[model samples]
Target: MHASATRLPSAAAWTVGDITVRRIDEIALPPQTGPWLLPGATPEVVSQLPWLKPDFADETNVLRLASHSFALTVDGMRVLIDTGIGNAKTRANPAWHDLDTDYLTRLAAIGFTPESVDLVLLTHLHTDHVGWNTRAEGGSWVPTFPNARYLTTRTEWDFWSTTELDEPRTQMFRDSIHPIRDAGLLDVVDVSAEGTTVAPGLTLLPTPGHTPGQVAVRIDSRGATALVTGDCVHHPVQLADDALGSCVDIDPEQATATRRALLASLAGTDTLVLGSHFPAPTAGHVVTDGDAYRFLPYGM
Candidate 1:
């Protein structure tokens, strides 16, 4: 289907201290050049980074990217970090095959439904980050948050549940991750453990090589902080070309050394980075732009 155009400002909540974070857009892809999705992203290296024009490229430079998700309320909890590219799955990339949009009606118009989500943070298991975690009902494939709790990372569920994928990532692990492990709610955790907590301000860092065991969702609260970069900085010109990766970064030199140590631990720090395929003001802050690094997005 995919017809709703002109809905630019999709959603973008952001609180931080009390912890809110919202960003629900499911598609905002226009300018796409750079050898077609970041192979050094040329246009003369993004026109020598003119602070990435307009809102991340397009004055002919072309780059824009977005496929969103990140609800994240705090104490009472309602997580949901990455679950885009979902709807009618059968993808071999024909721009994410067999699709439709209105991602859960834009996640219940931002109030978040799907049984009020309790937690579904899968920062890995790519294929557009586990396409909605399941939802094709009558024809089968279920668990679209039926009382959440989906988290991942037992080394990213033992490498996509015993690696061997091909036909569109083994039909995206048999329909969005084995129907959330057949509805037992799938919770693998142990993100290289040390009090991994996924609530009370949420946490889990291990920014692995874009896929390996990829995790990133920090959030903190009253003291304020935020991370959520699940694809490890997809576009923001890879925060000033840290060897520009993402041609499906399987290990582009350990995803460019995990994006230069998470942009040197949030360059100047006020944290708040939220970019899993960043597009419209997709939240940002990592600075220090001399040797390289600069994604100041939040509201500018």
Candidate 2:
């Protein structure tokens, strides 16, 4: 375990009709390689920004968890929103491959089984987002949810599958994506052309920004709604300064507009908000904090 993970609280869960959403855990990559996804401004830029601060977590807390993934269960379907960095995979960053957290086991506590997953919804194809897309099997990568169909945005697939993808992100296309495609289980979603109804009460909202074809998932039942804001707005800081962009974002300006639009949609309703990368127990609602906004955690 990393030194920072020790301070994390246990995982938490929430339900929307037949859909049960769980905030898996928190994740942090070193600041040097890239800026954290939300408000992905460079450290120097972050330092200069008026809203930026040195620390976002409690100093006494040892775990510095930041990113997150969610598991979604609806009707008879068990689905995972995004897979966090998986264990025992070799990466350019030595620290990344060495991570060995017990996220799957944690899922078991809430009645989820790896085999039980019916679909895996990937907002986009990023290394961290698809780590658990497959697992090691017979010395080769195999689908993590063998019975599930791995969904990716169509535009994202068209981009990454082409030579246009840069080196750093290209391997992610190979390592996490190719295997599923080879296995005949990858589903490319047309977020622009059609709105897919994967199961009852679940909908895919095309909220692109952080990536070319990024998307958000919405769960509604009996007028109660929840928007699973995949990477629409990574951190609360983005709400404060629309110009600040996460380091890895392909287009910062578009990302800002997407964030603002999402915030506006979730502003005054009881609609629950969930993020793929927020603090642990990642399900929460955004409320105005000062001139900006703050993430209000749902009861753990």
Candidate 3:
């Protein structure tokens, strides 16, 4: 019932066998960051695709859209795929600071607590992706979930920790990653192989290009599998046109390649696609709509 005025709520879940599935919370749609300047964009091409509304005009008038994140519950462990924007932090821009996040509380409402989380899987090192990695401890930033092991790909960890980033992205690592590392809770993982199973059924599938070592998590349990697409395909509209990469994409060509291949493999299978920025209940299946495929949001 928490549907955005400009978007609809869609969720469909069933056990792969014994694993429980749930979409914990969304980051909510952010307000437009630019003035409307496009001229060729048509309403017909925009409004028809719910995910394309942001590209047409501001939807903030009607929708309280936020970013998206997912919780994959397997065994007795609750694995959070990605952490949305953290509550408060310093950045190059004020917009990224002072945001509200009730993530831990939200998880608790669904019977998950910080201690119930055994692993925190970071798809990449973007600020928004790692916001909840730490919390204020006395006068220091400490691991938010002292009991959880935060997992990040070795490639990503090496690059961000070593590379010199602009003020914003640099601040991101300083806040979300450094603190966890200092706390001895950050795990640098090598997921360069086909995939690596962090737990019994949760695997990290490398889907780099959004960043050097970006990855999407695949969870298999009870004969069911779900792909947390991270930022491989930020908006569902990209599935229709793989050439369109986001401004933040580090390698547009590679990202497009990664997106298509991943979506194709899950197109007609039992695999459910979970996109990081897709609308809440951000999961669905791909269906052929003539030459282009369309996303059918799961209905539960």
Best by TM-score: 3
Clashes of each: 0, 5, 9
Model 2 lDDT tens row, 1-300: 000111223456676654556777635655433343433444444444342232333322211235566776677788788887777677766546657777778767666678888888888777778888877778888887888888887887886767476665576666677888999999987775345666687778776668888888888766667777777766545555656667677777788788887787676556778766555545556667666565655541
lDDT of 3 by residue, 115-170 (tens): 67788999998877888877776876787778999999999888877887888787
lDDT of 3 at 170: 75
In terms of lDDT, the poorest run of 10 residues in model 2 is 1-10
Backbone clash tally (model 1): 0
Ordered from best to worst lDDT, the candidate numbers read: 1, 3, 2
Models ranked on TM-score? 3, 2, 1
Per-residue lDDT of 261 in model 2: 74
True-vs-predicted CA distance for residue 216, candidate 2, Å: 1.0
**Candidate 3, which segments miss by more than 4 Å at Cα?**
1-14, 33-65, 93-95
Output the better candidate (1/2) by TM-score: 2
Error of 1 at 51 (Å): 18
Instruction: State the number of backbone clashes in model 2.
Output: 5
In model 3, the clashing pairs are 16-222, 17-222, 27-66, 27-67, 28-65, 28-66, 28-67, 29-65, 29-66
| Model 1 TM-score on a 0 to 1 scale | 0.34
Candidate lDDT (C-alpha), each: 0.79, 0.67, 0.69
Question: By how many angstroms RMSD does model 1 differ from the true structure?
Answer: 17.8
Q: Write the per-residue lDDT of candidate 1 for residues 122-205, one digit (tens) a residue.
A: 888888878988989899899888898888889888876677778878878889988788879988988653437767878888
What stretches of model 1 exceed 4 Å from their correct place?
1-35, 39-73, 86-88, 92-116, 119-130, 137-143, 147-220, 227-233, 241-267, 272-274, 277-285, 291-300
